[model samples]
Target: MEQTPLEIQLKTLPESPGVYQFFDREGKMLYVGKAKSLKKRVSSYFNKRLENGKTRVLVGKIDSIRHIVVRTESDALLLENNLIKEHQPRYNILLRDDKTYPWLCIKNERFPRIFPTRKRIEDGSEYFGPYTQMRTVRALLDLIRSVYPLRTCNYDLSEEKVAAGKYKKCLEYHLGNCLAPCEGLQDEASYHNQVDDIREIIKGNFGASLTYFRHRMKELAVEMAFEQAQAIKEKIEILENYQAKSTVVNPKIDQVDVFSIVSDPTHAYVNFMQVSHGLVVRSHTMEIKKKLEEADADLLPLAILELRERFNSDTRELYLPFPVSLPEDLKVVVPQKGDKRKLVEFSERNARFYRQDRFKQIRIIDPDRHVKRLMQQMKTDLRLSEEPRHIECFDNSNIQGSNPVAACVVFRDGKPAKKEYRHFNIKTVEGPDDFASMTEVVHRRYRRLLQEGESLPQLIVIDGGKGQLSAALKSLDELSLRGTIAIIGIAKRLEEIYFPGDPIPLYLDKKSETLRVIQQLRNEAHRFGITHHRNRRSKSAISSVLEGIDGIGEKTARDLLRKFKSVKRIRQASVDDLAEVVGPSRARKVYESLRE
Candidate 1:
């Protein structure tokens, strides 16, 4: 709730990129919002009486307000994502996309194979099609088999059929699902040609391939090779199937996204759906808290731009957050007729439902309270030019002797600075010396930023107090980068803060919420950096064993390690199973070498 008399509050807020909070009486948070031009957007709320139910409820509790100006909308979006996650404000219609989309995976090997999966694996396989629909994935797999049935079984060829002969042809081959080239029933020369055809179809040049295949079909028939001609016909049919589905997409659109916004006075719910390659992939929601008395002309463009930034756009499309007069660059689409217009009504309804159903829990929190008190103590204790506006935090994570990763998260004006968040793979630091790790990350992060001519943070937050702080400070000093950045290390328990050159942890005034907020940012950065490091470490530990095995060169080791992520799992596999993965008859040797 904007606490101040609406007019005065509007004047007080600056017109810049930043986040603002509305508070009710008792200093409780009523709502939170970010904007490119705070003055314009915040002022608009006070100027007009919100007829929207949501706004009315939020406005009724107006009390006090605060603002934190930022640099860009990208920076603003990052802050918004982090805030929404941390606060879970009642009024925000959050889009929690826990559902990882399914995609097609083609194992990268001497003879690569294609398939579908919902889980993402960091393996030596080429992955494609994070297609939103399961049906879309299945359809492609079915088409691949019908058109050019490649191996679909996850079998150990060494134990299954390789021992019988170099190539005895599997069941699919005898059944005509496969070309039987393995058994030499179908010549390798001819089978390679079929593989070429399959590759072309997957690449989306179906029409040209279909035409070329048609000629092949006719030629086969002229030679009285009826079976070969029939195979060609099947491939053509698969191509046609894909085209028919894509035909539903309105040609006039090329590609487009339809969005609608339904908001009450307190919070605005922007509901959106995207259309690509003539199909709808997903729908998402953007939540904005009640506006303050500042102006708003920049909100619409920023919202749409953020939406665009989050998704892919290799295919041209329009992403509308409302029934907007499409901008010139947006391809200004007004679907007056046909299939395109029909979609508009459905999108519009989602918009309406989204608007009305945006039941949000609004809490106005003044982070400034905690941050200000902490800054004051720091000022009196060590003294500074001003309260820190931008604080950069660093942490390192890794398993014992494994893949190590580091993360740097920034907080600007008490809000997260996402555009500046960075990750690093631990290098040069041999063992898990937490100090050395922090030093490496700090050095790498700052050196690169300076080289790139990026803005430096006003303050630095190290995850640990004392030792970690000393390591980071010393690292910066060695690089001649220490003085400008105000350094502080936050101790976890009791939330103690240790500033540079101080052995004792500093305690801040209890009333300052900004201090607590900064501590939270530092802790979160530590958590994030460690989780990434652990994941990399686990993968590295698994990858290392393959390299140690004799005869397993980089590519081969990568292929095996990728297929089975860990050495323990591979160790449990029988010789036959191992052989099947790499080739025929090598499983015994592989098993022996890996065990050694």
Candidate 2:
């Protein structure tokens, strides 16, 4: 039920624990929230004293409200997190904090094996934390090296080597950090004792360690060994100084690794925050390729595995945009509220800093100038609805009907999904017919959706005139997916955009965000389609006989075909650099083969 009187909506709210919703006059779902008491929380907006940016905006347009009472606050928390994710409410803290990072793992089993890992093992091992802070982890490692003297070695030791004295200790051994178990300087029993002490240190039992050290210092001083006392005092100072330097606060808490991924179509920025108990001791950000598909949950796992494989680190809690299965021995924590929430929020904010740090514009070399202008002009005109959300665009490219191809690209919140970039090889259409090509691509795209029974797109843009749009609509109707998606055609008119679905072309006013986004999409489709087109053409262009000739191979041959298109031009190469068209390897072989 929807109503306009904000007071009436407020009166309907209950003081019970539940979730709430706010809607605009058009009944567009704007925000979804949860509270310990639904009535109190929902009515608080109408209370007139909750002067915050989000609250004020919500209050102003709150035509109606809905309530769902949960049994408890934890239920409310879970429901709210889910609802907010589903609705993507405007007011809630929308964080894309997914992407696991590496953490140090010590298996909680009978033989606790400590090593670097991002995966959480479920074998009943105590998980320490996600150490997100790089500096903190480094300092802690340095301290562990000096005080705990844990083994950093990872080499296999043969019994013969131990007996023959053929193996020597590494630099970590010379520095008196690692136990040098391979050198046989420390037996398993003694090494185990040191490892147990190291575990205590990671557990932050510095008070006990400090007490033991102080007692030893006193005992040495009483024995009149001045040098020994001085050395002990120095070691104690190192331990104390390390504790003071690391962590953002005192009274260190258990270890946790926090991870946040800041990303769009073009890039991904990952921020790691390692906390020892409640103190933040390490933090760093690594920029990753924005070219990955964020929509595929499986892809995220692969990306994370790749990242951890590249730059492995020990961590505890792994705060992410998505929940990942972890090891039983590790303690992964993220606060939904209170102190840990603040840290997670802060980490998320840091992840977003890359928006300004770098803006890489990957442009298309193809003649996407007009299609680009159409996108530019569209954003120049946002007359009614929220510009366009979940836009699906399509483009068709072919080579004289032999290899017809079409690509459909998706854009969300004004960014492209290069990872979701798909290609269609015009199976149903014959020869250079863009309309039929469009029909084939559209049918296949929606047919899958039909088989799956999913929600349709909000808008569809085609890289052609009215005919292309009609083809798309026919496909939608055929698949019973019409009315679910709106269609618009962006046709090029002699280097100008003709949005027949709209009134004008190249409606370039100024600072057009829609235009920029549209241009980005069209260019992306063209680039992707043409790239796929070129690759197809090249693969069919020549034989390995040319490859065996040495003067030409893959990259160079493609370049030669693209540039000169004939062996005559390639054979008449002016310089080795010119022959270097494919690649250096091909160029070298080509030059040598030519000399022969």
Candidate 3:
């Protein structure tokens, strides 16, 4: 058989690191990917069966392939990221942060004036940030102004212009906020020195500024200028306070970027923390809209490059939640213990919180999208064939083998459907046989649903361990619905989830939304079962005590009990009092029965 052009291309491709682009029939880019071996990676699309539906579709749409060989895997990663952004292939994840972050720019001038800006120009001016929050920029600016008193006006403070006395200080000079640098009241050298200190502070290095202020304060105190010394003291306090608030870990840990990611089926949230001298100077959580079912390993690198570029972070050191491919020159630490690990965990917490907040907002604004995302998350977590939009949980309740009953609680769209809840009395299986009771209820519940032509639940939760799960499976097998509905059992002690024939249980994270929902279902079922069990026990006791008497029927017993709220009170009631409720003939019989 003759080989096709794609097969020939795949065979002839280099085994080196490279980026590959997939194009559709009409020459539109479908997807862009990076690989350590172009021959193996690109060939994988045709050779392997892609599990992700979107990836399978993307592969089906590919008409031609192109490759750009790189020297190293890291170079290939960077190129793939750049190509994805440049062309925005249909099957690539998109970094969704479009907000204009504020930066502290030091204007290019004789006496540089520093201010916050949203734009960066190609002039020789220095821009410190591209910070994640405007408030941080403002606070830094306010701190620098209070301590340094630099000029706010963007005047041409040239030497000749100042010598010619072409400018005058405004109310800023009167208020002592500026030293009148425009009028040469402050010298060029002194203003430049202040600018140097401000630059250090913006880089999250407060040592230079703090040392300068402390030295000045000492000089003023030595000269018996107590008021000026106190003023310097206040400036030192401000710098020290800000540094204290910003610093998070060991001050020796400097120039490192921390990245952590939390993701769902539709989106991924990546938190970036720019650490300088252990201070988290800039922290941001960005959401990425997934075009395919991208994993964390794929999404993290793209986000790392995009965020580092956007924030102008040149730090070669990174603290991440997991290992990833990057340039050999860059240090990547997947911290396992101690402060570095704590920092990574902190970033992870921020990403999770951001994801939850987005969920809350979406739930309020667009409930359908929120529900869809939640269902998708649950489906993935539980390894289900489809979304568990309608779920049922079963629990058996019996105290001392008396009133053995089962309660089935229904949840529609993650909320309890109270009207659909049903309770069952133990018919064939008696005593405290939880497993048998579970089998009977599950069999009966679905048997009726099948008989009535009602829809079955996507998931069934049995609130017990392997034994109960096995019992429930037997019922499903009898109904021939074993493969039709997904079922799992939850153990109460460890919150372990068990599947049929799978001995090893799955333990979800304590904070997982899926575990929370499962717990809610289990607890509701238990509560409902306990309530029904208690009611049955009360009714049985009443029947045994009152209905056991001869010639005292259920109606007379009910009438007597209604008049006296409790069985004990009914026993204490006089014959005349009982007659007022029931007739005198039945009243005497009831009175005699109570004494007995």
Task: Predict model 3's lDDT versus the native.
Answer: 0.83
* lDDT digits (tens) for residues 1-596 of candidate 2: 44334554455445666567777888776787768987677766666587577667767777766554444564455445545544566666653234333345565532244655546665655444345444555666566666666665445555566668877888987776666767787776765666676666765656766787899999999999889888778878876765322222222234566666665443466666555534443445666653445542434445445544554646544555566555565454545764466556666765554333233112222124334433433443633233355778899988677678888898865667667678888787657888888888999998886679865566777887667877787788887766556666666653234433555655543334455565677778888899888877766755343566744556655666676566555656655656445656666565566566
Candidate 2 vs. true structure, TM-score: 0.29
Best-fitting candidate, scored by TM-score: 3
Q: What is the C-alpha lDDT of each candidate?
A: 0.63, 0.61, 0.83
Worst 10 residues of 2 by lDDT: 358-367
Off by more than 4 A, model 1 = 1-383, 398-405, 561-588, 591-596
Q: How do the residues 1-596 of candidate 3 rate in per-residue lDDT, one tens digit apiece?
A: 75555655666566777678888889898888889998798888889878899888887888877665555675455455545645677778652123344567898988888888877675778776445467878888898888888888878888889899999889999998899988889988888988988877876679988888899999999999999999999989888887522223443466899999999899999999876633455556789999999999999999999999998889999999999998788899999986689888867866776676567657555689888888998999999999999999999999889989999999999999999999999999857899999999999999999999999999999999999999999999999999899999999999999999899999999988899999999999999999999999997898778888888788877777677878999888899988888879888998887786
Q: After superposition, how far is residue 413 of candidate 3 from its true place, in Å?
A: 1.0
Ranking by TM-score: 3, 1, 2
